[model samples]
Target: MTTSTTPAVKSSEDIVGQKYDRCLADLLVKAGVGFGAGIVASVVLFRRRTWPVALATGFGAGAAYADCDRAFNPARIPGVRVLEKKD
Candidate 1:
């Protein structure tokens, strides 16, 4: 008698969830960096007196970074095209 071994495969939902988690983590890091940058810039340029403006600027920067990052990332599966024969 022989025993068979098979690897466990992840479901589509699980795979998608993992991808979403990674994207969320990346966005969080980007937001933190943007906030820090805004704080530094505000202090250096405005003598640390523009709290409201700095907060808004940081939020906008973070959102823009996330949008661009999502747009530029390529899909896991590449597209395939079939060639036509010449008549």
Candidate 2:
């Protein structure tokens, strides 16, 4: 039987880059969950029907808006560092 040797692998940067992108995607999923939860809590607060309720509603709205912004915003991912290790 004849044997042939395989060529050496090229630079792994591409592979690592792909993995990094995938990890960022995972982080996005988690952030989305948090943002969604905040929105739900905000809605619940809005339903209370009083000044105190209104206060809570405002607080909740603030938190929900912040979280939603984080979830939808791709810019914040760097702060969370989903691909720090890969880089």
Candidate 3:
């Protein structure tokens, strides 16, 4: 997800906004591809063995979760932290 600091928004409000956007639904279906580029790029740039590996693993896992959501919607993991905004 992206982060922005807008004074008008509260901490919780930010999460709500993301949730309102169907964060999970949107993230899913990319087959760990949408964000894969970022992971690879970061790893290549920093070249930090520990951090790079960790990020790589995280990206891989996230991609898997997203892919799973596509095949079978990821059951609400709970505490999604998304604010789930109201229209």
Candidate 4:
């Protein structure tokens, strides 16, 4: 009896789609955290709350976080090179 082994191969489209999905999910999580923080801050600072202000703050925070993440974690951002230190 012989066992047949087949290797799994991923197409370019599938790989790109997966990467896109992961990036989107990461952004969503970051945005959610920012939104929650903005809401909490708004509540603490003012007796009244507004959706526009909260949303603006949330998006700003999310963008900032994404930028920082990409800058610090080069592995996450494709084509970005990380410099290594020489001993």
The lDDT for every candidate, in the order shown, is 0.67, 0.58, 0.56, 0.70
lDDT of 3: 0.56
All candidates in order of lDDT, best leading: 4, 1, 2, 3
Residue-level lDDT tens digits of model 3 in 1-87: 989967674587676665645545545534355446546766688664456555655675677665545444334554554466899
Clashes of 1: 0
| Model 1 C-alpha lDDT per residue in residues 1-87, reported as the tens digit of each score | 988879789998887787777766766776667677777877788778677455856686677566655544554225844458999
Off by over 4 Å in 1: 1-5, 49-87
lDDT by residue for model 2 (1-87), tens: 988989877677876666566556655665566556555655676563345444544565555555555655557755665555663
Candidate 4 local lDDT, 1-87, one digit each (tens): 998889879998887677667767766777777677777767787654777456855686568567666644668797867679999
Query: In terms of lDDT, which candidate is stronger, 3 or 4?
Result: 4
Please list the Cα RMSD from the true structure of every candidate, rounded to 1 decimal place.
6.7, 10.9, 13.6, 6.5
The runs of at least 3 residues in candidate 3 whose Cα sits more than 4 Å from the true structure, single-residue gaps closed, are: 1-48, 74-87
TM-score of each: 0.53, 0.37, 0.31, 0.54
TM-score order of candidates, best first? 4, 1, 2, 3
- Positional deviation of residue 25's Cα in model 2 after best superposition, in angstroms: 0.6
Name the weakest run of 10 consecutive residues (lDDT summed) in model 1.
Answer: 69-78
Instruction: Please give the range of 10 consecutive residues that has the lowest summed lDDT in model 4.
Output: 64-73
